[model samples]
Target: MPPLLTGSLYDAYGSYALVPAPLPVVAATALVLTATGVRRAVSHRAPAVAPH
Candidate 1:
């Protein structure tokens, strides 16, 4: 019974610890995607070559 309780507690703590790990990755991906989209939009609107 003691071992079972310990395992359950360990599993709970491990799960809680893992919960916050992906947040930064998700935020960074969103930022990169947004920046890429904005850059593409701006590029498409501007002329390809500048005239003197």
Candidate 2:
């Protein structure tokens, strides 16, 4: 089983919703991926300069 499966299952039961069971995992993954992508893009945009 996948790691997120357990959390998603718990969420499903806790909320008593059957249709949106995977919502939490999907949202979390999207948020994490977006943040990572932004960080990488910003880091690559400019180079650091050394002090004289």
Candidate 3:
């Protein structure tokens, strides 16, 4: 597998390098974000109880 970004950009006067994140890091980040979103949604949908 290749990194998300590759190669460099060149312009009339200068060149810039492109760095890509490792696949594992990207996957981990996505998983965490998704879990957080799902958790928030579930909590919002759950009913709240009141104590006497």
Candidate 4:
């Protein structure tokens, strides 16, 4: 059961709808991966200047 759905809400779903239950997990994983990749690329774009 996904955290967003309560017991009552989850219970309302029929067997057919259960097939797509993993969609949310897949979407969340993709979002996390994209954010991490973007953050890494941006952070490494410039180097710190060395002191004389």
Q: Give the per-residue lDDT of model 3 (tens digit) for 1-52.
A: 3422333223322433333334578889999999999999998895878798
lDDT: worst 10-residue window of model 3: 4-13
lDDT of each: 0.72, 0.74, 0.60, 0.74
Task: Give candidate 3's root-mean-square deviation (CA, Å).
Answer: 7.8
Clash totals in order: 0, 0, 0, 0
Better of 1 and 3 by lDDT: 1
TM-scores of all predicted structures: 0.53, 0.54, 0.51, 0.52
**Global CA lDDT computed for model 3:** 0.60
Candidate 2 wrong stretches, greater than 4 Å: 1-17, 47-52
**Collision pairs in model 2:** none
Q: Report the backbone clash tally of model 1.
A: 0
> Candidate 2 on 1-52: residue-level lDDT in tens?
3557656766867643453666787889999999999999998987778899
Candidate 2: what lDDT? Answer: 0.74
